[model samples]
Target: EGDFVIMGTDGLFDNLGEDAIAARILQAYNMMRIDGKVARAVCSWASQALLNDAFNTSLSKTAITPFSIAASEELDLAYSGGKMDDISVLVGMVEHQVQA
Candidate 1:
């Protein structure tokens, strides 16, 4: 399967949903494409953004994301209400194969 993959820990998903994460990654990827650069820096930035979003979601008092709900229900009460954990994200871009 030659496809781009984004592998992340539960902490990453606990705060942000798939749609949000996809949008962020697409934003980062587009930015890098416009800059004519594709490197680890972009990936790192994306990961940091995810972490920040997660942390902020945890702090927000107004609304709770579905991810947070699921996450809380699955874990201890201490982490029941919000997303407060170690976030980790990894993005892998697949290059087109060269035909022989």
Candidate 2:
């Protein structure tokens, strides 16, 4: 129930896997819960976290990324490490109003 709505470009997914992305958002979710704040309050922090992670991963020579794996098997090419590209990430939350 605390998960956020994440949207991004190919660069984001290319550098990071599902588990890496989930951990970042979950950290923000947990922090917001502890602070007793709305999910929206941590949106900025979560987005930044994803950006930093993706950027780091993209630059890591030893880090295996989704794009690398696909390029290796599907494309039958010799590819290693993360792929550098234009990454954009957005973190948001949905709020609902219950009837009285």
Candidate 3:
């Protein structure tokens, strides 16, 4: 199966759960397929979207704080209420095995 594998740091996981991540990735994948998108483009879009979504979610007042009170306090001065942490996202689309 040529499935897409998304790896990210705690910063991302704390803001977005597996289902949220998967849904976004799947939506991106479908859009790419429809537009005949290349792997690099897909990966780039997925990475950027993941990062943005996490950042935005962290900033939302309704969202539960992903960081500890101390951590949130430290970050609040910088991010102004957003969770602060290093966020790294890598998306790998596995190659499909083609039968001869």
lDDT of each: 0.69, 0.88, 0.77
Q: Is candidate 1 or candidate 2 better by lDDT?
A: 2
Per-candidate alpha-carbon RMSD to the true structure: 4.2, 1.9, 5.4
- Model 1, which residues run further than 4 Å from truth? 1-3, 71-81, 96-100
2 versus 3: better TM-score goes to: 2
- The residue ranges of model 2 lying beyond 4 angstroms of the native Cα positions read 1-3, 98-100
Better of 1 and 3 by TM-score: 3
Report the C-alpha lDDT of model 2 over 32-97, residue by residue, as the tens digit: 878876776689899999998999899988788998999899989878888889999999977676
Predicted candidate 2, C-alpha RMSD: 1.9
lDDT of 2: 0.88
Local accuracy of candidate 3 as per-residue lDDT tens digits, 1-100: 5588899998888777677788889977887889988877888899899999888877775565444344557767423234667788888788776899
Structural similarity to truth (TM-score) of each candidate: 0.69, 0.87, 0.72
